[model samples]
Target: MSVVGCGYLGVTHAAGMAELGHRVIGVDVDAAKIATLAGGRSPFFEPGLDELIARHLANGRLRFTTSYEEAATADVHFICVGTPQLGDGTAADMRYLDAVVETLAPYLVKECLVVGKSTVPAGTAARITSMLRVLAPAGESISVAWNPEFLCEGKAVSDTLHPDRLVLGVPDEQAEKVLREVYAPIIDAGVPVVVADLPTAEVIKTAANSFTATKISFINAIAEFCEASGADVTVVSDALGYDARIGRQFLNSGLGFGGGCLPKDIRAFQARAHELGVGQSLAFLAEVDAVNLRCRERVVEYLRKQCGGAFTGRRIAVLGAAFKGGTDDVRDSPALYVANLISQQEGEVAVYDPQAIENARRAFPNLVYERGVLEAANGADAVAVLTDWPEFGTVDPDVLGEVVRSRNIVDARHALDPARWLRAGWNYIAPGRPALQPALVGTV
Candidate 1:
């Protein structure tokens, strides 16, 4: 089997397939990335992925290359390229998807299945099928399917190896049979597989992302009400999570969703819906996107308030630059966005992340990057924990207090224990939560 586009999705999928005992060829247009993977190194940060790739590469089951010709003889080809949002509009840029199909189609000289795992707008699979029909030398012998991926950033390795469910979009029994054989190990382990047509499969990923984004924004909207009502959004979210129908996932109300997936996926979903003439059906997604962005601005305003109502001449320490924890990806990161917002206001910002500082530095070059949390917090007027990294939550407020000029901290993600910080003589604040004053000496 061959996986086209050696990115987050492609690299993980290729290594995962090899772990399932299938010989895998990973292809990418970037020679540098290929060289990195060919030498058993991952270009990006994903927990357990580097080890998995190195294990497979060492065992001879996995290999990477820049040439599509090396992938020509594979029985199955998975399209795992990225479909980022277009620069001009909210619509997805499909050039990468198109290039993959056009470049790999002519190499299909034998009966093979070309499966798409990239998250794309609906009806893309059928269009790719048509392209392959015309471009492939084997003509009708080539089969196209959509097997949308559901891997999360931090937990991608676990998600790939032990998926809760698999959605396979295939035209016929043969394509299904081929995919079933490809994933027999997972299916045999009792993971349910939902077989649908091309368009339905394509809709599944965007729909899932949109729904998750809506869930996150819904709680954020409630958090806005909580702020006005003097109610704790955390308690409200806890109460709401008690309902089985509501559940607790994506219900946290601090900083709203942002990353490579949810932010762009919802916008792209809305754009695609507009193109299909059902724009009004998903109109609320526009508000969902707005609510998520507003979370960033809300944090900026809170930081300004912490800095005595202005950002000028303020030194702010921002902990966690990744959108969320456990990944180095900073694309559309809310934490980075808020940091940039503060920096734009002339705040001296010191940003730190366990894994994302390099990526964050590249994304926001003007902001100061720190190697560790303590270093970022050193001499800071205020500290803001934006991303929910576990280390940020466990940092001792008293220890952090020793190095800062002031004892002001904003728990933007609700990551720190407010009672602990307040007890340590630090004024703590969070979104949708009341600003609590530091405990007086000798007070319980």
Candidate 2:
């Protein structure tokens, strides 16, 4: 099997396939990424990926290449390239997907199965099918399948190795047979499979992510009511989570979803809906998008109040830069957005993350970078924990309290205990939670 486009999705999937005892070739246009993977090193940060690459490359089950010849010889190919949101933020940019198909389709000289694992708008698989039929030397004999990836960034390795379910978008029985064999090891391990037609498979990913994003925005939108009514969002979510129908997966009432997938997927889904003339059906997603963006702005607003109504020359330490914990992906990171907002307002922002410092520095060159949380907090007026990394949740509040000029903490991701920070001589502020009213900031 060949896993094309070795970014977060492809690299992990390649390593995962090799782990399941398949000879897998990792392909990418980026020479550096190919080199890094070929040498058993992951170019990006994902938990346990380096170990997987090392183990597989040692056993010769995994390899990396930039040539299309390596991919053409494989019996199955997985298209896992990025489908980023368009520049205008109106639709998904399919240029990368198109380029991959254009480059690889001509090399198909046999009956090979082309599986697409990227999160794309509905009908993308059908479009790719049309392109392959026209371009492939193998003609209409080759099969194209849609198998959208369900891997999460931080837990990507595990997610691929032990998926809850497998969804295959197949054009015919042959496509399904090819996919079943490609994933035989996983199926033997008891992972259920859901088979559907081409277009349905395409919608599954977009629809799933849209619903998850909506759940996140739903809780965030309700948390606003909690803020206005002096209610505790934690308690509200805790009770709401008791209903089996409403699980507690993305229910945390904090800075909303932002990563490579969720934000862009929801927007792309909306755009596709609009294109299909059902725009009004998923219209609430616009609010979900707005609410997600507003969470970051609200953090900025809270910081403004914490700064006594001015941001100029104020010192703020922001903890966490990746969109969420466990991965170094900074695309559309809310933490970086909030930090950039504060810095733009003339605040002295020192940002730190456990694993995302390098990527964050590259993404936001103007923001100050620090090595450790305490270093970022040093001499700052307040600290905002934005990305929900576990370390930030467990960091000693007293130590951070001593580092900052004012013991003010904004738990933007709801990742810290307000009682702990307050007891440690710090003012705890968070969205959807009561702020550090002067009455509540008295000595413990």
Number of the top candidate by lDDT?
Answer: 1
The C-alpha lDDT values of all candidates are 0.90, 0.89
1-444 per-residue lDDT for model 1 (tens digits): 999999888999999999999999999999999999998999999999999999999999999998899899999999999999999999999999999999998888999999999999998988888898999999799889999999999999999989999999999999999999999999999999999999999998899989999999999988777776666789989998999999988888888888888988999999999999999999999999999888888878777777888989989999999989989989999998889999889999999999998889889999999989899999999999999899988999989999998998888888888888888998787777752522211111
- Model 2 is weakest, by summed lDDT over 10 consecutive residues, at 435-444
lDDT of 2 at 10: 93
Task: Give per-residue CA lDDT, model 2, range 332-394, as digits (tens).
Answer: 999999999999899999999999999999999999999999999999998899998888888
Worst 10 residues of 1 by lDDT: 435-444
Give the clash count for model 2: 0
Model 2 segments more than 4 A misplaced: 435-444
- Tell me how many clashing residue pairs each candidate has: 0, 0
